[model samples]
Target: MSAPQYLVILGMLVNVSFALAAHGTARTGRNNARDNLVAVAALAACLWWGGFFG
Candidate 1:
């Protein structure tokens, strides 16, 4: 209900969305090293920001 909780929720949503997108890409054979790197970066960002804000 507060800002930190909101940040945590938002981070979770972002991570889930990224995971789904990465999975879809892999299924379609369109996934590449760069895509994987980007996904990893996004996940790291989500964790860092979420922890910091929370």
Candidate 2:
């Protein structure tokens, strides 16, 4: 796959990971989930652009 395709997949995974982390936090009402959703999302939206700004 090309770089754009890779970015798309990475962005998708980042979104899913974010949602998973959010749901887990909501499930327990605390910041206990061990994940880096923000960093991953930043990489997709900023570094990769996820095919939207590239």
Candidate 3:
């Protein structure tokens, strides 16, 4: 894969990691709006990056 593709893949991995972390926290009954927001932002960023650079 090219550099941009690698970056997009990395961004996707990061988004997934964030989602897993958020899920774990939620399972613990933690009110982590910030984490959820960050995960959403990461997903949006991944989408934008993929659209622009993929």
Best by lDDT: 3
**Tens-digit per-residue lDDT, 1-54, candidate 1:** 578767766776676666666654555466454555576577668867777534
Model 2: which residue pairs collide? none
Worst ten in a row by lDDT for model 3: 24-33
The order by descending lDDT is 3, 1, 2
Decide which is better by TM-score, 2 or 3.
3
Off by over 4 Å in 1: 24-54
Estimate the TM-score for candidate 2: 0.44
| Residue 20 lDDT (model 3) | 64
Q: What is the C-alpha RMSD of each candidate to the true structure, in Å?
A: 5.6, 5.9, 5.3
- lDDT string, candidate 2, 1-54, tens digits: 577767777776877666666754545465532445665566567755544545
Residue 48 shift from truth in candidate 3, angstroms: 16
Q: Rate the local accuracy (lDDT) of all candidates.
A: 0.64, 0.61, 0.66
In angstroms, the error of model 2 at 22 is 0.3
TM for every model, in the order presented, reads: 0.44, 0.44, 0.44
RMSD score of candidate 1 (Å): 5.6
